[model samples]
Target chain A: MSTLTPTVPAKPARGLRSTEGKAPRAQRESPFARVSAMIVMGVFTLYFLVPIWWLLVAASKNRSQFNSTNPLWFADFSLFENMGNLIAYRDGVYLKWMLNSAVYAGGGALVGTIIAGMCGYALAKYNFPGRELIFNVVLGGVLVPATALALPLFLIFSQISLTNTFWSVFLPSLVSPFGVYLARIYASASVPDELIEAARLDGAGELRTFFTVSVRMMVPALVTVFLFQFVAIWNNFFLPLIMLRDETLFPVTLGLYAWNSQVNQIPVLRDYVLIGALLSIIPLIIIFLLLQRFWRNGLSAGSVK
Target chain B: MQIKKRAAAVALLTAATVVLTGCASGSTTSGGDAAACEPSEGKVDLTFTTWIPGMEDVAAVWNEENPDVQVKVQTGPNGNGGTYQNFFNQLKAGNAPDLGQIEYDALPNFRVQDGLMDLAACEGVLDAKADFVDWTWGQVNFGEEDAVYAVPQDAGPMAMFYRADLFAANNIAIPTTWEEFAVAAEAVRATGGYITNFSQSDINQFAGFVWQAGGSWFENDGENWTIDLASPESVKVADYWQDLIDRDLVSTNPPWTDEWNNAYNTGSNWTWNSAAWGANSIASGAPDTSGNWSVALSPQWAAGDNAAGNWGGSSTAVFKGSKHPYEAAQFALWLNTSDEALTMLNKSANLYPAAKSGLELPALKEGVEFYGGQAIYDVFAEASDHVSPDFIWGPTMTQVYNDTSDGFKGAVTGNGTLTDALTSAQQSTIDALEAQSIPVNK
Candidate 1:
């Protein structure tokens, strides 16, 4: 491990070119080609970034400025007032929604990641009967759209007297087949069979071997799975729209959507929706930044092995 | 080992089945979901879902007056898609609110689903009928021996609001007839202005014109519905708008959109062919244009025609699941007909009242500053009397509105004319109904 570690930093420079091409890292390329590449990337960056910039500027304006002012420029710094309105409008309902989103995403992702990891690890390492059939079924689940399941889920939840409850939303969010798929691929690649065999040889039971050895090796992969499930649950609008009736229980996305829909009826809500949207992004960005180390480790670990 | 594996799989399968059925059995299908109408201990608690804000304060006033019943308000804001769909889901679950504020057009949609209880059966609910204009009452209390399903809360009688300064500067009289309006539209366009904005996807706005032209898209005959949305009267209205659109007299941007908002706010559009609700929305949206605006009667199809149209409005309905039907009915009546309720709603909720007593309320009678001290309600009051009576809404009015709205998109996109909008929308409604084996008159 020590001998390979010193060479690892030097390895990727030579390694990437073999896969990318034998071309010497674009250094020998034309200046025109380089300039064009820079321009293309710069334009694409602006395309994605301008809307976000617009939103940041827009959240500050009141109703009249929202209508009359230039869309790209800041008319006034009424963001604090807009935030105040958003928070104070319905007795701090915006913060309640933010907390609901955190609970839904954090709780749902934590539960989803554990189940998906166990199932994926079992599928990858075990030789049980109908294992391929199970894997295939999970793969098929990845192809089915989440939206297609919501109505049926709603009907089923309704019959069970579960609709409008928090579980109706959280339970549906926990079924992330794609997360399981990623986990299976990740587990097979990251955790070697010989390590499990060694643990078994050390008088470890099946459950203990998997928990102590396999789980430790799978931490980075599981973080990736947690993030996948977290984002899916976080941005989920339609499921919550069908499931939750109480605004107090609504996730930030659904709450913002309801407010956004009311801009026509109550125009003052327009600024609130914009500010709320800008606020919704902050948590997702925070989660991403906080888990940056795990995300990077997960990506690189697969390649190095 | 093989036997153990198979047995474990079978056990798992059995457990899943048991859990599924156990969960399925929890549905309260046969009743007992909702409490009964009578007061339980001493005071009654009422729940209401509304789109209008500031209603809670009015309920607070009601609570202070009558200590026996305390009201809690729940609002869904947008009122139609999300709120109405949730209401339906709640109805199916047997947990619907006691009273729901439903739009006038959608009252039939609720009635067909048994979502509303007939207030006619609630006793003394209809006593307030004399306090409201006869037409607003007609919408809520029509069909099946004209049993009332809801009480009129507000009405949006259609009117024309224009930039008075813009018109006077351009040497235009308030265009009274459609022909004169088109001529003035060209003059306004000469100075890079629009006569008004046209919302192709807003079927409700277009329906107002069709109503003023004396067309009801749906006619009920016993068990069947006569779907005649493509009738000569509707087509005439469509043709008039299509011709103006082709001439570039009106901007074909959809309403309630950012593009339309910017254009309307900036005076790229000179007029608003709007319902009484527009007065509040415009004042809030573009406060700079407040004093420059003025109200006129909805333009006539022919010169001197007094026929007018109604647009959007909502009524307070008593749900079938309501525990306090009597209390709910009384509350609905009090909210609509009582002088205090009308004034409160007018001042706070900005509703154009449908009640006669509301006409005398100082808030309603006072000239709005946004309309340059114009008593806009005076115009709406006269327009309310001209609303064509006995307009039968269908069991699927929402479905019709959405389908027709989609059809109208083609007109704006220039894929087809408004004529196609009428025909396609009519055909779509027929196909939808016939597919369900509902009888349809061709």
Candidate 2:
């Protein structure tokens, strides 16, 4: 612990020097290579951002303006009015869906992170039988897609009489194999064996040592795990589509999809769908911007070690 | 000892699976029995699923009036989009809602699946049959003696919605016959516009044309089914549309898309030969083009003919597993036949009621400002009266529509003619019926 404390202060100077040394090398590269890289990045950035820009512009227009006006530019800034209509539509059902999404994604990610942390911690520290086999199985789980599991999950949920309930979606979302994999790798790399021995020598229990010391060091990795699971569960569509029947129980993704499908029958819903889609992504953007520092640290931690 | 305990737990799980399977199979068979239509002993709470906008308000009105029979409304996507698939899954899970909005063409599918309750035994169901239009009643009855599968909610009688301002400006006359319509199509093309946009995915609109040509696509005797999608009248209708597409007089933009809406809003399309409900579609889809449209009778096959066709209409049916069939039947009847409910539905969703008295509602009599202040419902009223009552829908209309839509898309891309599409769709429809164990004449 004393050795780690001194290195933490020295690490920043080393990082600064490394970047300072590379600055001249970057300038010495050929201008054509730099120009080509910039061009490629600029084209890809435009390709990705153009649709979002269109959505923002369309969300500000009314139904008539949407059809007659330019699609890529703003006609009138009715975004606040559209937001008011979206919130007040159908007795504020949009707010209810938003609350449901918060519960499903927020709650699912929190519990999932804890479970994956514990499972990964055990795999890294314990010398028990079948530890390698268990990790192998989780690796296999990471390879399987969520869509393939949805039908089987629905069948099991129906047999147990849990379909159409919150648990049907939340329960399946709680299992994040990628989170487990990340936690295991980080736990092995960052959690020191000497610290565990010292804590044990001080008469602390294994669980207490883990909760107090290991979890503190694993913060960056846990935050990374939480955000990944958060985005995955937030954008999930198929599971909730099949599990839930009531509109009030639907997450925002499913609710927006339902409204979009009805635009043909009810044309005014088209604007609502566009505005709802724009609002639904705000949380994801906010989350990424908020936890960006921790995510970056988590990604580079294993490489640094 | 660990092995013994694990074996015991596995045995218990196997037993539970067997019991659940038994219960699931048992419920499905009992769901089909019509003898379970007795009224419940206490207050009933029924769930009714539909896609109609503002249906919650209608149900709220009923809830205020009838405390003993309360309805919980659930809104979803339109029937063919996703709601029907949900209904099937819910039925299999034994938790389907008591009442659902089913289109007239889809009612046959529900009936053949044994998913609908025969409402004939419920109170006032048989006596209330006279309140609805004859064809709508026939749609629910399916020529059966003592069976009423659903209560007809709305009817979609077809007519022409034209841009009166555009026609007058182009010095072209409103077409009254098919031949005149084709000639006007040429004129509209010459003026850098299309007569109308041909919908490649919405096959129901094409079926309306065939219906106006006095063609029947399917006929079901008590024992078996007959498929005739390529009849002479149908082929004639198909060939007529083929010529228009070949000449590039009509655009083939997909329906309900932003491009399709923009074409109408910009006056690039001059007419839409759609059902009565299309008035709202145009009004909302092309809000800038309001007050310039007018409704007329659908173009006739011959001069001075008084025939119309039906397109999209729906019924409210009580599912077979509902425990409160009597309460569900009462609510369904009131929602469709009552004057206040019908008027509210028309105002909210622009639904054309299936009841005969609904046509006389003051709301239906007034001129719509979007349609140049014309009383367009008058045209639809006449069209409703002239629709042939003998047009029958088959038990697999969804499958038939899907097959025909795929073929139509191919035809639009110049892979085949419309008649060829129909001929191939006819064969696939027969094959689908056979796969479902339905006896079909090849």
- Which one is best on DockQ? 2
Candidate 2 is graded, for docking, as acceptable
As for candidate 2, its clashing pairs are none
In candidate 1, which residue ranges exceed 4 Å CA deviation? A1-44, A122-136, A192-213, A296-305, B1-46, B55-72, B77-79, B302-305, B321-324, B339-344, B412-415
In angstroms, how far off is B152's CA in candidate 1? Answer: 2.4
The DockQ figures for the candidates are 0.33, 0.44
User: What does the TM-score come to for chain B in model 2?
Assistant: 0.90
lDDT score for candidate 2 against the true structure = 0.86
Off by over 4 Å in 2: A1-40, A296-305, B1-32
Model 2 lDDT per residue over A1-305, tens place: 12123334444654665666655554444445545755776677788889999999999998789988999999989999999999999899999998999899999999999999988888998899999999999999999999878766877788898987889999999999988888999999889999999999999999999999999999999999999899999999988877877778989998888888767656778989999999999998899989988887887774565
Per-residue lDDT value at B170 in model 1: 76
Q: After superposition, how far is residue A196 of candidate 1 from its true place, in Å?
A: 5.2
lDDT of 2 by residue, B203-232 (tens): 888888888888889887654678989999
Worst 10 residues of 1 chain A by lDDT: A1-10
TM-score of each: 0.84, 0.88
